[model samples]
Target: MATSRGGSNLHWRNSNPATDSIRGGSAQRGIRGGRGSRGGRGGRGGGNASTPKRDPPPEPDIVAHPLGELLQTIRISDLSLEAIKTSKPTDITDLKYVASYNWMEGDAPTIMIPGKPPAWTPLKQPLRLKEDAGTYFRDPNGAQYPRYPAEPAVQAILNSNPTFPTSEIDIFACGSTMGNLLRFVRASSKAFRFSVEVVGKTVFFVRKENSPKEVIENIHGFGHSFPEAYTTWEEDTKGSSSHQRIVQYNFGGLVCVMRFECDGYLRDGTNQVDQKLSSSATSDENDNIIVQALKNTSVSHVFSTTDESLSIKTGGNEVHQQSIFDLKTRSGKYKRDIDMSDFLPVLWLKQIPNFIIAYHDGAGLFRDIRVQDIRNDLRVWGQEHKDDIQQLAVLLNKITKIATEDTRGLLEVYCAGHDLEVRRQHGDGVHSLPHSLRAEWEGMSDEAEESDDSLGATNGHGRSNFSYGDEDENDSSDEDKDFTACSADTCGYCGTCSY
Candidate 1:
């Protein structure tokens, strides 16, 4: 949480190669690499025999959310490129910024207006960095849902002066859900599963596994510590721990809204929108709703109760989508490259135009750092991966169609390695929003259709879209296939699977 290390000494490392390599090895041992163990490494930066963590700590205990229940399961084969060629390929279009909020460190779930990310303030010279410690939530609010991962986002939307249209939107998801589907399209070899439920016309994809809060363990890098050492939260939005942003776009024919975590932003909130567009090789489709986020507070929750936990504090500068960036830290010892093949899709999903990567010696001294604006690069990658993207569009359309067929409205999506399945959610599964908020969100159906129409989101011959934990007697009867998400043993990477 300290401000980025500062100095005017931006120079490549000039240290003994053999000595630095040994020190980097010790540094790696001091870090845990995934979301579950995000900031929980507690040993010195030494890979010594005495380090207790040489044996990783156990994964978190996650079970018995009253909501995850299987109503039905429809199995289908892996989507093929050949099959995609036969069907009309869907293209993502009409991207736009919808709403955003920051999490407050408090007892109940709270919101900060026009929430902003940490500012990018790199230190002038490389310095020995401290390691991260303690626990972190994959999603602080989501970890506490029935779960309504999208509830706070929608509430933040409605509370704005001019809310984005919601009626015609076909799907509401997070980066993990969509990314899982995209992986299926590309035919990935990993195992993954999530829940899908329908509230109104929008299908919500929730990634509620066994444990929402996880203990840090089994890590070997500086992904957490690097950011703590390098980035600083700006003044206006102080006291915030995490920021979530929502973006809407038409992929294939479906009008989609997705929420993602933002790392931080460039301090100079200049005309990044214009700058991004000027540099992009594509058209306005990439320019859908990047800048229309919430501004003023005008809360009007008809179902407002004195106990409502959502409080939108008024403060924060409007951060242009283009000015924001995704960050990753790596060790320079292995000379490992930052794989764009993996990172690009994430940037594309969030419409992030900038990426920052810092590479440090094992001793925690960062010397090789790069900040890039890769909007055009993402466009090119999308085109190159057009087949996978098209399959994703088709898959989404199918899920949407089938989920709507069930009168129950509530549903779940489970992808058991190799094939995709759509099932019924536990009747007890929590609603995506509170009763009042749910009513308000569904009521937006009136204007969402107009927005969907204007944006040209197609609803057929194309796709659709999944969370939570709770143990049930029914879980005993359910078959555990290649992966069983309800147990810590199967919650790949212990909830921070190698994404």
Candidate 2:
């Protein structure tokens, strides 16, 4: 995601004369002259002094018609004048009317008029509303009510629990519509958090949360999909089968590999009080005991295989899985007994950590001249623990096999420990071997010759007139040394011979 800065500024101005006339000029003048004539007089007069005043600027015309006269005849009264007062409170109070004739309550004259009452008719049945019910209505008293039939009564509750031939039932619902039903069941039960329902039968196992503890099965094979779900065992045990009891879990963003050892048998070699495993357990309970065991086990290590680069969480820190293996290399805790070489390809894709490269140098196999500062803390650790070099060599050979072409070539140069003509065949072939490796090898060779000369002098005790060899012979010895150096360069380590 590269971001760019600086851009050309674009300025826009309205060029339409109609828009300009509507905004800045008089509407009446613009209407009379039309759009093209607003600045016509000024522009033409400046160009031609002899141009006339354009027919006396055309007089403003006002032609009166019958509608105008009718509008003039209409009158509007002025209520503000004192002579035009229309409202009188005094006249209203004094107003009275005398009755021309008096009449009693029933003496009023009655006139008969012919009329007929509405004919009797049969009432029609009310219309039936739709299933969703008609719109509700509000009564005059402000209470709102639905205009639908009364709701049906609820079904009677079951007095006894439902039973089946098997303790656990497998229910299979087909079609896309079943998704909603399965989701409903999943949402209704908190105990079925890890339950998965496919298109086929979904076996529902009934297991007690506090069921008797059982042994957890060991995970086998690489590239196994993560478990659908797992449980944690509170108690731990020991022996060869103890590795099987170990679980991997994601804790605090790191992959933790914890074994179910006697409660205090820590992988770090610390000890604590051991928890005893139950001995007198019955075997004829049910198949749910196995399900409960799985539900009760905890993860021992946390790892994510989703990405090409596998990451393991350890010691509360998230790091590459290769780093975890490197740590195991130092601690000698890799009890799984799997060949480390088998995972080199996986690590190569993930990029090998620098510390692992340094470990090879510290093991006193040819120094891994590829890594920067190969003599760091990890290298020193590797030097102190040389017993693991054989395993480390296997991993190194696997890495060399899977490394990029350029990396393989660099490893070859590092192993050769001197510049070779064959290296110049690739990119930057003109460049010499790394100065550090070259200098180190030169110093080692010089020290070796010095030690040899000192040993000879010590062995030739009491000899007086000892003469050194001639210059020509010395040149021959130097040539012999160069030949030996060339022979050593051919010794393959990274599986690539520089010739």
Candidate 3:
């Protein structure tokens, strides 16, 4: 039922109309009340009636009261806009790829496996969109592990041969939580909710997407269908569902870990594997730095499969960061000039360099398709939005500080009309990891602190044996190197029996 759009003026950059000091809640018009029963004075029946009003008394300069003792509210109007805008992010020293994984096509929470993202295999011939309905994932992560959306990433990292260093990380978040905070700092329109929990020094920020079945209304475009027709899941990841990658970076003195879902990657062609998405994605050596890093960490753990409810497998090739891309399909009938401003922030947040916008006629025929490398646009956006980013850093610092100080670990952040409030979680809050993992993580944190202090470390700063690669060739024993070990810790995918 989709249409083809024509004559696309796909400008790589669409200037943002908004200035700084932005906040939500405006353009909310009140409804006109019905005519009064008296039908007198300034009622609807009182035609052309005007009443002379007396001047009201001036209000006092009172402080905005807190919603609750524990509840902390954040509103743009309450803060100094100039100060936040001029604020420069300081002490951001390190940034690196933390860990990555894909939500495999299964369930444990019904064969929850780490399935790498599918490769970009484009088709030469045009095909019917609606007619051929292929399998796809709406919310693969949420659906697979309904308990926690971030569980797979944690599982994947801990399950790898070289376990994660819980002490080094100050924050663990996905694109949703990070985006929500950024949106709040940038004074975006839509309201968002997320959960925050303090696990040792690492504060976990998990996204609360309506529910396990996150409803996406009015998805009538080719966003889903177009990709199905154009890209093909390669041989290794043929049965896999969705891909997600995690990156670690330092911003405003905090070592933050962020996870993001990849749409697909661009190859030289279907046959040529491991090619950069664009010229911008590569240098003289062919592979970009991110690609090499991805290659170093990329490894598979063969897992057992179950029936229809869940299908777990391994042997999927990892797509490098530079080759990854995000795609959007819009109706090309009106020859609309799609803006890049709205899309650039998301791409930058995800570290996605390539963007594809496809236009189709009303009846499912796309011709005006263009692939754009928006690295330059992202750089410009980052420069322009430095204030917003700085505000984000400040806000993050504030949240982390509050969460760390609080005795009760679980907290919820809710923003509606005007105020953004952080309160003690009402119900049983979602746990980031299993009890075993939490214990191990907290134990290691203590160990790292003790180790730092004993070694005359300044302000007790230290890292606990962190490695990017899943399998460390140099450090592995004969059993580990020979793949003879199969514990729940070694292979997170296995529930029991090496599955």
Best by lDDT: 1
- Tens digit per residue, CA lDDT, model 3, 308-423: 22323345554556666777666656666456665676666766767766666655666555566666777788888877767677777778877766655667676764667787
Q: After superposition, how far is residue 72 of candidate 3 from its true place, in Å?
A: 0.6
What is candidate 1's lDDT per residue for 217-255, written digit by digit as tens?
444445566655445555667666667788888876788
lDDT agreement with native, every candidate? 0.55, 0.17, 0.51
Minimum summed lDDT over a 10-residue window in model 1 is located at 293-302
Which segments of candidate 3 are over 4 A away from where they belong?
A: 1-70, 78-95, 107-114, 131-139, 161-163, 268-314, 454-499
TM-score of 3: 0.66
Runs in model 1 deviating more than 4 A are 1-78, 81-90, 144-147, 161-163, 269-308, 446-499
**Each model's number of backbone clashes?**
42, 22, 14
**Each prediction's Cα RMSD?**
14.1, 53.0, 18.4
Query: lDDT tens string, model 2, 122-228?
Result: 00111111111111111100010011000000000000111211111122111111221222212221111011111011111111111011111221111010010
Q: What TM-score does candidate 2 get on C-alpha atoms?
A: 0.14
